[model samples]
Target: MKKAIGLFLLTINILLMSCANANQIKKGDMLFKITFAQGFSNDTLSLCLNSCRIVYNRILSSDNTSDGITDLQISVFKKNDSFSAKIFQGKEISCQADIRETIKIEIVLNGSSQSFTIDTKQGAYLSIEKNGNDLSLRQTKEQVLYD
Candidate 1:
């Protein structure tokens, strides 16, 4: 029993220390750079479509908009780097592209926002929902929809 109690206390201490090391984010700034492959200069989706894809990263904004992000934009391709990317249209829609992109998302819960980083480019999906006075962030390969 003594050993069990010691283990539990150690676990809690480790978690607290890790959380303290996380970055404190606000509405704007703190950009995460993503690199995608490109082919030509004329510009065509087909060039990268076969090799790369896009994913939506939704994070809660301090602006209080329902969508969280107010003015969201990403430049996947750079003339110098030859990195190309595309953002899906409409609400909660994505290209279903396959790549290894990691981005953090924030969700509003209990009148506040909590951030979570996910790798949608690596075929990852996330669902945030309220579960009895608490919030849950689930990451899986399955589709997650919100009302």
Candidate 2:
């Protein structure tokens, strides 16, 4: 009986961990940063955050593939109260920097990186690993919805 109980407990633990790990992006989670606007404008921040959150949720909800050969690489980790993800596809670079903070996310569909910075403390900007650099709040709407 104890053996059966132990097996059940182990199964439950595995399930819990898998669920937690799968949800790398959570909507309305004030903890993960992805700025939509610059400066201290709360309205811009809120709009950007929510819109991108939805995009991320959709992205992480499944294993995204491209060209049937290249697939997205989404690595997620957390330190203290913050969580971050390095999302990208195509070829991997050797000089990729470790990203961990509230920052604006650049969803680059076209493989060119556009650089921009937002100065703020409310949250860190979110971004795609190397594909996005010149993304705007409206760009999230442009992200393709996978069925």
Candidate 3:
């Protein structure tokens, strides 16, 4: 029947459109991962792309005085060669970043403040570690697995 054939064609078109959307990655899109290696307690972490705050996490004494978030992942996509874009976590939020600008990270703990900057055009992985009174930040390479 013509109705059955038409329905089949419509389904096929929908499938193709979904596949194309899923595989599309625009230019200037970047993925970043931040890891708190050790000594993160009762701290507030803020991540900014250029000047837009994309992620913020705070852990106080009442919540869990012992541990904080260990890993965080963020995906940034540039909008049409402009300085504005959307950041994707579980949802999309408006953010701004320039490829020539650096990502800023600020942390406050124990009445002390620390600031760090990551080059947006560089690697994707970053590690933060605190030893005694010193805090260190470094860009790390992702581990590769072979099967």
lDDT of 3 by residue, 32-72 (tens): 55555566656565555566666566442222323443444
Give all candidates' CA lDDT scores: 0.38, 0.35, 0.58
Write down the lDDT that model 1 would get: 0.38
Q: Which candidate number has the best TM-score? A: 3
TM-score of model 1 (CA atoms): 0.29
Q: How many clashing residue pairs appear in each of the predictions shown?
A: 3, 11, 0
1-147 in candidate 2: lDDT tens per residue?
999999999999999999998855444343333322221111111111212331222222111333221233333334344444444432211212333343443342333333444433433333232212334432232222332
Error of 3 at 8 (Å): 2.7
Candidate 2, position 61, lDDT: 14
Model 1 — which ten-residue stretch has the worst lDDT?
A: 38-47
Model 1: per-residue Cα lDDT over 11-47, one tens digit each: 9999998888563223122122222111112211111
Candidate 2 to truth, TM: 0.24
Query: C-alpha displacement of 60 in model 3, angstroms?
Result: 8.9
Model 2 regions lying over 4 Å from their true place: 1-77, 80-107, 118-120, 124-134, 138-147
Better of 1 and 3 by TM-score: 3
